[model samples]
Target: MRITNGAGLPAINEAPGAQIAEGPAIVPRSASAVRPAGDATTLRLSHAEMQKLPDVDSERVADIKAALLDGTIVFDASSLAARIARYHGGPQ
Candidate 1:
């Protein structure tokens, strides 16, 4: 999705390790000069970088799902109600 500034110009979205041009000429303050039509840039994460991320604990997720199914997961009803009331600007 493209984000626009107050002038409806496409916002500059920079990525890490990306080379950004220095000087006012390259980085224009005006909306029209920022990016012309047909100019598209894509950002992607490398496979090695993606591999550095942590894996989800499937066993723990399964346990939580089972607990939820059997209604064994405990919840504070009064606390939840108070939060709901606060969110709705009602009396706690």
Candidate 2:
């Protein structure tokens, strides 16, 4: 049987108790079978690639920790308000 929508497009029509046919069962590949040796597609990170990451500034972190302990850290309210406004697409 055929069915048509309000836009006059043909749609599928199935009986109330009709069952859909199942497709092929998916089988997962074994761990070693997933990747073979000397595969060009495989990615490897070298020592230089690891060194490219930005190093944490321990001195600045210690200063921030000291300010937090002494309650000397100051936050800009106007800058935070502008950022919130921009995120919500409201007035600048």
Candidate 3:
């Protein structure tokens, strides 16, 4: 049955109870799926690539750890927000 709308467009919503027969169900590969040996290749980042990460001063790290131990440490949300904003091109 051809169903048309006010604008003479094919009314897709009119065929509500229509059932279209489909092919066999495709079973997806689970976590235990057998993968090819060479397909699981991972590229190891070099020392230089890892070294490009942000540098943290050892003294500041120790100070933060000390503060955490003494219950005087408070996380600065703005710092993380700024970092995330910088990551997403909001600000640097």
Cα RMSD to the true fold for all candidates: 16.2, 11.8, 13.5
lDDT by residue (1-92, candidate 1, tens digit) is: 33457986545674566666655655447886576543442223455576776698788999998998898997779999999999999995
Of the candidates numbered 1 and 3, which has the greater lDDT value? 3
**Candidate 3 C-alpha lDDT tens digits along 1-92:** 34567987757655678754566567678976886655544323455576887787888899889998898987789999999999999968
Q: Estimate each model's TM-score.
A: 0.28, 0.28, 0.24
Backbone clashes in model 3, listed as residue pairs: none
lDDT of 2 at 32: 73
lDDT of 1: 0.71
In model 2, which runs have C-alpha deviations exceeding 4 angstroms?
1-54, 76-78, 87-89
Clashing pairs in 2: none
Tens-digit lDDT track for model 2 on 57-90? 7888999989978889876799999999999998
Between candidates 1 and 2, the lDDT winner: 2
TM-score of 1: 0.28
The CA lDDT of each predicted structure is: 0.71, 0.74, 0.73
Candidate 3 structure, TM-score to reference: 0.24
RMSD of 2: 11.8
Ranked candidates (lDDT, high to low): 2, 3, 1
